[model samples]
Target: MKNVSDEELMILVSNGNLDMMSILFDRYHVRIYNFLLKMTRDQDVSQDITQEVFYKVLKYRTSYKKGKFSSWIYTIARNVFSDHYQKQKNKDQRLNDIHYKTIGQETNSVDDEEIKEQLHLALMKLSHSDRELIIMNRYQGIKYQEIAEIMDSTEGAVKTKVHRAIHKLKEYYLQKI
Candidate 1:
C-alpha cells in the first residue's frame, strides 16, 4: 500500500500483475484526463481520448521504458490527439478555450472573469503546437526535455517554442485590451 515509483509499477504490470496495472491507471488517469481535457477543450473528445490513451498504455505496457512514465503517457495522448484531429480534418482557426482563472477564488469576480476570458481568447489564437507547449510546460509542469521527447523535438527547440509562444501570448493580451 505504500507509494511506488512509476517505473516500479510499470515493471509490475509488465510482469503480468493486473492489480498493479490497475493501481497505475488510478494514479495517472485523472492527470492524463485533465491534460487531454484542457488540450481538446471538448469533454466528450477528451473522454474518448482518455480511454484511448489507457488502451494504448495497456497495449504498449511491455514496451514501457525507464525515465518518466508521465512523459510516456503524454506522448500517447499527443499522438491520439494528432490522429483524431487529422481524421476530423478540422480547419477552423478557433481553438477551444477554457475558463481557468479564479480557480480557487470563492467569490464571484467579474473583472477576473473578463481577464480569464481574455487569456482564453489569446490561447485560442495560438497555433496548436504553441498551445500544447504552453499547456505542457506551464500548466502540467512537464520538463522541457521530457516535452521534447514526447514531441520528438530537441529541448532547445521546445524552449524556443515556449519563449516565442509566450511573446505571442503577450501580444495577444495587449491587443485584446
Candidate 2:
C-alpha cells in the first residue's frame, strides 16, 4: 500500500476499500493541519478542521474521480475552511497567541527566531485571501499549476495573485523590521 499512489488509494476507497483511506490520511493529515493552522491561527481549531477534512474525504469517497488526489484534498480543505469561516464571520478572527515555534524549524539564533516571528506576524496581517495564496505558494511549496487547480483558476491568474500576495507580505514584513 505504501507504493500506491494517492489517486489509486482514493479510487480503492471510493470502491468500498475503505482501509486504503488510512494511507491517504497518513500522507496528507499533517500538511492539511499545518495549512489549517496557518489559516485559522488556532491549533485546536486547526486540529478539529483537519479531522473534519479526513471525515469529509471518507464521507464523499464516492465522488472521487481519479483526478489529482492532492488537488481534490486541498479543495475539500478549502471548502471546510470556508464553511468554518462563514460560521465564525461575526466573531473576531484576528490572530493572537499563534505559536510558530512548534510548527517552524528550530533555530538556535535569537535573530532567526525573531525574524520568523516577524514573518508570521506579517502573514497574519494580510487579508485572508492574500494570506491563503502565500501559504499555498510559499509555505506549502505547492506548484502554481496545482494551486490553480485547487483554486479553480488559471495558472496565470494564480501566479499573478501569488506575486501580488508576496509583494503585500513583503511590505508588511518590512514594516515589522
lDDT measured at residue 87 in model 2 versus the true structure, 0 to 100 = 67
Q: What is the lDDT of residue 116 in candidate 1?
A: 75
What TM-score does structure 1 among the candidates reach? 0.85
* lDDT against true structure, model 1: 0.81
Pull out the clashing pairs in model 2: none
lDDT of 2 by residue, 97-164 (tens): 43433564577899987987799888888887899999998879999999999999999999999999
Q: Model 1: C-alpha RMSD to truth?
A: 3.4
Off by over 4 Å in 2: 92-106
Query: What is the C-alpha local distance difference test score of each model?
Result: 0.81, 0.88
Q: Write the per-residue lDDT of candidate 1 for residues 1-177, one digit (tens) a residue.
A: 457888888888777786787887888888888787667667777889989999898888888867578788898899998888766656543234232332344548888778877987788788888988998998888889999988889999999999999999889988989
